[model samples]
Target: MSMPIESMLLAVSLNFLVFSVSFDDMIGQSFASLVPTMAAVESAIGLAIFVITFRVRGTIVVESINCIQG
Candidate 1:
């Protein structure tokens, strides 16, 4: 439930931070100016990633917990 969503956010946040650093060099616009576009694209991509992962893994924490307790 929350795990996939949190994972998605973590991935997006790391990528956004990394992209922000080089954005100034690649694009002439300031980071603040590009925030809207960056946020939109990243949010869509992050949600897609979460959906795909959730579809494949399907709340994997329960399985891991079972394995650990066994």
Candidate 2:
């Protein structure tokens, strides 16, 4: 439903923000530096997995609800 999508979006955005800040601090570098490349890639992969799982699980949940209603 819309709720799941909205929550997933919020989670992904927050994850990206936290990853960026932590990665920068851990390497003592700014996002403009080369050190951010690996961190950015990892974050993207994690976000993708999170989104995929959310979609799959949300579909299952909604379908179940529909079944019950009918």
Candidate 3:
């Protein structure tokens, strides 16, 4: 489950990074100058959400399996 999700995330992030870099250079500006600040903020928020959800879901899955086995 998480493998696919992680792979998708990796692909999406890589694509965005590549696109942003090219767009920035084409516009004659530093890649990070346009959106690095905002990107950092967004990345933190997304990471937090991912961590919380993953932890909660993982806990639920573990509990369910344990319950079934016991």
Q: Report the number of clashing residue pairs per model.
A: 0, 0, 0
True-structure lDDT of candidate 3: 0.56
Instruction: For each candidate in the order shown, give its overall lDDT on alpha carbons.
Output: 0.59, 0.55, 0.56
Instruction: Output the worst ten-in-a-row residue range by lDDT, candidate 1.
Output: 24-33
Model 2, global lDDT: 0.55
Which pairs, if any, clash in model 2?
A: none
Question: What tens-digit string does per-residue lDDT give for candidate 3 at 17-36?
Answer: 67767776443334334344
In angstroms, the error of model 1 at 27 is 12
Name the top TM-score candidate. 3
The candidates, ranked best first by lDDT, are 1, 3, 2
Clash list (residue pairs), candidate 3: none
lDDT by residue for model 1 (1-70), tens: 5456556655766566677677645333343355556566767887886676567667645554354331
> All candidates' TM-scores?
0.36, 0.35, 0.38
Which scores better on lDDT, 1 or 3?
Answer: 1
Order the numbered candidates by TM-score, best leading: 3, 1, 2
